[model samples]
Target: MAKQYDVLIRLLMLGDSGVGKTSMLCKFTEEGFNSTHIPTIGIDFKMKTLMVDDKKIRIQIWDTAGQERYDTITKQYFRRAQGIMLVYDITSEISFRHISKWLDMIDEGAGSVARILVANKSDASALRIISKEEGQTFAREKNLAFVEGSAFSGDNLDEAFEGLVKIVMDRNKKDIDEQLQSIKLYGSRENSTIDAEVKPGGCCS
Candidate 1:
């Protein structure tokens, strides 16, 4: 069978319970939203294929349960992730406050993985406790990409994934380039004939 995509990127979503991690993912991948709050029991994933820079990129987004009990299971996914979405509900101050703790966890396990701070439920303007400026300030401080949107209205929802994929792809390119440069340097040094004494038993024979 032919390969479906040129690149496979794995993304993980994390936040306190009720922060709309699953909803945000559903809106982005399925273009559907459900208002009823059903807590994810553990970790679940959804797949979406997008054409990024003319490359078929398949994104596997892993949605993790936000409850503390599931932290162990969720942390296990961090090392495998290419990007992580640290989601928080704009309407819930407690959830927003917990973003730092989530960041700490990402630092501990994900180790420089591309990350985006997502302020969800922007449609709930009446109940919004976290302002867009606040989210932007925090993101800037942490050098993280930020997006404020609502899964219900699908506003700016795609930006979260698009931005993350860009970061991941850029990092991947840099790594590949560095590897090639190192190989080129090694080849140049190896081919240099300076101070060489011919051993007749080897390739010189």
Candidate 2:
């Protein structure tokens, strides 16, 4: 078979328990959401291969179990992640309040990793304890990419995932470009040294 993608990216969704992390995963990957609330027992994996700006990308999403007991395992996934979505329920004040702690976790595991601040369950506008303005303010304060999403309504899911992917891809491209440029410069320097080493007799150096 022909090559399917230019890159395979690992992304993780993290937050406190009952922030609807799994629901959002199902919403984005399966285009469906589960009404019944089931706490994730362990890490779950999903993959979607698609074209982004003419580049085929296979995004491997790691859905973390949000309970405190599973946090040890969840933190392990952070190290290898290219991007992370820090999610929280709009209706839950406590969930919103814990964003700083989650960010600290991200720093400890994936330092300076690409991240998005997601105010999830936006469909719960009526019950929203954390206002959209509040979320935006916090995102600005943290200088983080931000999106308000609703897994139930399939709202802003694309924007959130795509935004994070774009950030990661851009960073990857930049890093590769720098490395290639460095190699090119090194090759030029090596050739210059070789030319200099060739004396009148062109003897081996």
Candidate 3:
């Protein structure tokens, strides 16, 4: 049979309420955003397929509610996540400051998933409370890819999703290589056992 390539990557978007987590996902998947506050109730999921490095990657993105009360509810999705987009509002300093707490929750729940730091609402440059340099520095400190994007104007939104998919694909490739090596080792051991089990005439006793 011809080799089939199907890679599934689960990604979670997290941030305080009104940080555009849902809007970002909507803009990325549907190419549009809503102006009203349609608060996510529990968890909303969307899937998109992309070609990364010539491989088909199915991205399962989970848009999580930002309300603190839903923290426990959202934690369930983090366990199986491959990548996480930590989002913050550029115009909300309080939201920006709470990033560490959110990261802590992810660490405790999701282990060591690949992460990207997203600064949303780039269209509101006039009311920006967080600087790009500051967000970049924080992302670097946390070892995350940084992206300042606007879901409203649709600027740099594609790059954000592309960047995340690239990271997830790279990690998946490494994991697959390791698994192949392990399978090879196991096969070799099985072959050795079969060789020893054969008699001089290749007949079993």
TM-scores, all candidates, are 0.84, 0.84, 0.83
lDDT of 1 by residue, 1-205 (tens): 3546566678888999888888888888878877778887777777788988886677888888899999998888899888999999998999988999999999999889989999998999998888999999999999999999888898988888888898888888866455446645553222222113212110000
lDDT for predicted candidate 2 compared with the true structure? 0.79
> What's the C-alpha lDDT at position 44 in model 1?
77
lDDT of 3 by residue, 1-205 (tens): 3322345577888999889887888888877678877688767777677877776556778788789999988888788788999999999999999999999999999888888899999999999999999999999998999999998888998899889888876777887456446654553121121123222211000
Instruction: Quantify how close model 3 is to the true structure by its C-alpha RMSD in Å.
Output: 14.1
* Candidate 1 segments exceeding 4 Å error: 174-205
- Output the TM-score of candidate 3: 0.83
Alpha carbon lDDT of each predicted model: 0.80, 0.79, 0.79
lDDT of 1: 0.80
Per-residue CA lDDT of model 2 for 30-60, tens digit only, reads 7877787767765776677767888667788
Model 1 root mean square deviation, Cα atoms: 14.7
